[model samples]
Target: MNHNIIFQKIETVDLADVAAIEQQCYPNPWPIKTMQDCLDADYQCLKGLTELSPEIRCYAFMMIGHEEAHLLKITVHPAHRKKGLAQAMLHRLTLIARINHARKIWLEVRTSNDEAIRFYRRAGFEIKGKRRNYYRYKDHNGKQIKEDALVMCYSLI
Candidate 1:
């Protein structure tokens, strides 16, 4: 764990680094256009960078509504995993949600991602429901497959 890591808003400069991490973190990572879309609107996104490096180590993308925030994605570089960066990012996001008058936060994680499930559970998110075949999978031949998604929610109020 790097004690000198800093968390900040995701800027255009951080997108390349984030894309690299996103590609490695998810089987069907968001495309550059989607990332741009997330950045172009009234959404909330944050990046984690190391004091010694110019690259982003982790990133979280969230959407805020009237009284709830949807955590769209959270990813940490494989090299920097298990170092508490994701938890730190989540903490910051929760604070931001609170300041925005949000009473709850929601997110969906893949049923196969046990590590993320544990992390979210430890971060105070509870399993609320499930979405069937909510995630897309691609075969070597570019065929699309589907997987179940687990819905998790965190109450801030």
Candidate 2:
């Protein structure tokens, strides 16, 4: 990652940019209200940006509690990808989870997202189990599709 890239807790001012990244990255992005709710719930949220601007190039949402951390979402904008931003965000989240005394960090990924699966695996996240039909979305033809979610975990201790 570039040394100029900075990571900080996301603020309200960053919502629009964060929403745009979500829309661009996911076919079924989380609603703005949901993001707001995460903020309201005081979830662990971080935005990654360059020092030259306030625009968020990447972000992550994780909830830390009960001896574990659950990664709710993570994304790096398409234009800013391939520059190690996503990995940096993941590393930051892992560090935060460890600092909070979490025994493990967990995330669920859509089984079809092969790139993300590989990325998590490379980061030492193991496939622990599956959530059957955990995700539902529509295809280009407007047909509904149901997909499984793979539960992955990284041990912190």
TM match of model 2 to true structure: 0.94
Residue 96's lDDT within candidate 1 is 93
lDDT digits (tens) for residues 4-104 of candidate 2: 68999887777888888888888778878888888989999899988789778889999999999999988988988878888889888888898999999
TM-score of 1: 0.93
The residue pairs that clash in candidate 1, if any, are none
Model 2 ranges with Cα > 4 A deviation: 139-141
TM-scores for every predicted model: 0.93, 0.94
Q: For model 1, how does the per-residue alpha-carbon lDDT over 1-157 read when each residue is reduced to its tens digit?
A: 3467788888776777788877788888887778888889958888888778878888899999999999999888898888888888888889999999999999999999999999999989999999999997795579988989999999998
